[model samples]
Target: MEPTRLVYEAWKRTEKIIQNTKDAKGNEIVREVEFYDPYDVKHMEKIDSRCFLCGETIQEGIATKHVFSDVFTDWNRSRYPIGTHVCPACSFTILTNPKNRTSLRNFSFVAEEKLHLPNRVEMRQFLVEPPEPPFLIVLAVSQKKHLAFKGTVSYNREIYTVMLEETEVIINRKEFTRLLAIVERFLFAFTKTEVQTGQYNQQRVLKFGIDRWEWFEEQVKPYRGTELLNVVMFVAQKVEREEDVLCFMGLGQKTKTPPQPHLSFMPSIEAETNDVDQADQICGDKLNDSQKQVQSEQIQLELF
Candidate 1:
């Protein structure tokens, strides 16, 4: 990752931390400073995100949220700085222009998912002095709607106040359950398939088993033809990430094996059977060991 300018604090405890740096002449630099890690504080405010339009419970882990600027016509005549938001299907319906086919693509959504997460840019922490309460916390959040661009960050927190760039999202019991379900599904699907068959790490290798495909399809098919189109668009955006994971797991690649001379299976089988019988009659214990080895080899497709 490229270096970016950021002020980071090292947390010693929930209420102790130290901010150890500052910018120098437009160059990112660290200096001697100290504070407490507020994360260890016994009491801290927690937040949760719900669908503003439909009132449906949005899962925090998989829920899509984006950040965008809404124009304000107040004294400042400034844009309501962008902030992170829940990408509700209903909210899309309420905020979008149906007549403008590309309006959704152009507006709303976090311009990019990776950029939307606070922790994506790794900020190094240093200990120049002691530690403060309510120090900076790195958070990752997602909206149901995909960003139009792949790497944009939202500044919506600026809307509420200049102090916070975005409101903190509080996680709750129901949201935790939803996140667990998605993770479980991903794990099961990951383990059920062959790891690298023909070719390796190709996007086209993202084919899923019939059952796994059906599971994902069912959840998404409901909105396949919806006028709101947010869900459909979001799924399309997720396709790239899905492909990346499949490749990372070796599901989209072929395993390599050494080339060896081969014998006909029929002849090989007959010879092995004859050899086993002969060994059994001649050396009982050694023959038993040999048979066990052969059984294991059979189970392993004789890869060795």
Candidate 2:
């Protein structure tokens, strides 16, 4: 499916749910949609980092006045910090519309992010614990409903899921393209086949819930736990384009000297000498979604 089409379908689904009034008090519940836009960017202490949204240097003045990032999460959470740097434009588009955001970290924030609808995994009963120490607690806010519409604030913690096999092959630029194409093709075919059978639903499939993840692994049990399945989950929705399959590792510069990697799951990140809004402890404090652009320096995941 085209990326735009898949994104639209997801939005349409959310729209239907939103049409009904909240607190109607029935079995049918519309899961709240969450986003990560912060207060006015002007008051924010700007970090000397690149904009995670467009990969451009965040110039002084208006270009990056609204920039923000989340705090470094517990080292036990994961090897990398839990956030990235986002530009103002991206902050507006992503925060303003539910149709323009995705749970996965692919695609540019300048563009509308694909929506990641809630599902059974999102239900409290099926939440899965991360395998390693650094508990990857992805924080989100329900700021989208406030865009052009009145709504209340809600906090949500989502798991950062890894769901593919990264070849880690040393390939030239041309080979890299071919590799992505092949990986995408196989996944598309597999998903199509599953959908044709009674095994998958387009809307609910591809979620990274613990039970779902284990079930997905069961299908290819032989490959489970092997080096073949090292890829991260791109989104909670079905496959659409190459962006969902590939990872944008890093897009910002260090505001301070890089901190050495810690042996404990909880690693220490050097904060900018002038400003630091987060801590290296439980990773409680947060900025916004755009600040999560710190993948390369904090995480060494084998990506596409």
Candidate 3:
């Protein structure tokens, strides 16, 4: 079935459960509401309007932002432009549930395939786990405006900037796969630190500590092109060799030479060097005895 039809059917199923429920004293609850039928011939003769979302003919009922404010109020304006009419099917699909609304924003559906509504398990997964790759993460404020909605992915010495527009989602799967792989490698190289929290004044409070993701993000900003892959690989290699990963990634180093620019799109070496001094102060002491021995041996080899 088409995505719209599938969504509409799913909404009907959910609506049936809600409408057919019994209240106290075995009373069948009934709601006074009008449901639209897009295929009905009599309804089709009423108006010749088109849906703003799927561009389908509005056979029966029409929906507007004012009518369905709950659905459209938090919608992305680029995806759902203002002053656009919604067809019955499109309106019902969006009004299915809050989960469906969230899925619509964060996921791209195949045009010919049926769109599946996100279940509770999938919703939980979105919070605790990272998506496989080539996925969309909608970053928007309360007004539903895009915020910093662009990122570059590097793979096999080639860089691809995945422009995340408010209207569409475009991604190069190969580049995204490579980018995620590098991120996994970078994460695996580090030792997992336990976060401690305590109950204070009827709320759970963080005692101390933060994830290394901020450091990763800072180090990665300067190398968005081909050098990004190399930098990640270098850090992974250092970790394997028992060398200090933070120092290699320019986090724990007091003084360092600026990296020479290789690509035309690469940021200025001097600008990238500016943040190193600040990072040096936050260097972690995670190196073990073996790591110290490895560093000493490397120094001796350099001297020889």
Candidate 4:
């Protein structure tokens, strides 16, 4: 097996190094993403030191940014003009230092137009808990609704949720109106079928809620006395589909078990069981057919 694997690796490396690695657009790749800086004197001294965060040190050279194409095309070595440079110290700092890790994670701001909607609106949605430290906090303002919402996303969970700060919207009348108009138009124009079916809807589910403006205060109090006039948005969920089965170890993976048959026993009759607890509460609220249709349409529009 080792011999066969070695032969395959040699053959593959020969082909890749010859055809793809040659004349790679190292510059273009460099242009697309930002690189970490190691030029600082303090960081430079830590060059041979162990990674501050992970504690592992690469022997080849100073640790630098690791870049890879998402689609896995030919390796464009030259594209990364500004390569990541890390010393043992930085590597360790990155993995172990909570403050440093948080700062690094917070730097992942979405570029403008990355979340553009059809009519030139840009979305500022985030995770309830981002998957990286220095959890993400976003403030969004919509011209149509003249609304601003603030929310935080964590960095550790697969599930992403949006949060609306209970803060007030401070935009002038026109912008606020425009923002609301966009939201309402989306609600009215979207069709129910769109929400009920398709991969896109499955990927981005909308979650909405309204509470006293105090909610915003509690959420943002840590950043005390910050301007509240600029934030306004609602919470939503970001969903992803996995192609393969996922395993959760130990915590007892959920498995289906057939229901056990009940054995009949002598009935216990305590004189009608105190009137069968007539006061037990049961929720019966539901949208009627037309209302359901409209709600579905609203979901579709928001999704779009």
Residue-wise lDDT of candidate 3 within 104-165, one digit each (tens)?
A: 33332111122222322232222122243323222222323222122222121122222222
What is candidate 3's local distance difference test score?
0.33
User: Whole-model lDDT, candidate 2?
Assistant: 0.28
Between candidates 2 and 4, the one scoring higher on TM-score is 2
User: Which predicted model would earn the best lDDT?
Assistant: 3
lDDT of each: 0.25, 0.28, 0.33, 0.24
lDDT of 2 by residue, 1-304 (tens): 2222233333434433221123556455565444433334453446555544344454321232233224312223211232245444334433333355532232111111224333322311111212232212121223222121011111211222221221221112121221222233235335533422335554544443444433333333332233222221221123343232222101111223232121112212221312122221111122223323221111222111
Clashes of each: 33, 27, 0, 57
Candidate 1: tens digits of C-alpha lDDT, residues 204-296: 235555544444333323323322122112211111234323332231112232222211111222122433233323323332464434222
lDDT by residue for model 4 (152-249), tens: 32332232222223232222222222222222322232232332221124222332112211222222223222222122223211111111001100
Among residues 3 or more apart in sequence or in different chains, the pairs in candidate 3 whose N, CA or C atoms overlap within 3 Å are none
| Residue ranges of candidate 4 with Cα displaced over 4 Å | 1-49, 60-304
Model 3: how far is 246 from its true place, Å? 15
List RMSD in Å for every model shown.
21.6, 21.4, 15.0, 21.3
TM-scores for candidates 1 onward, in order: 0.20, 0.24, 0.33, 0.20
Stretches of candidate 2 exceeding 4 Å from the true structure: 1-28, 34-39, 44-49, 52-54, 59-70, 73-86, 89-114, 120-219, 226-304
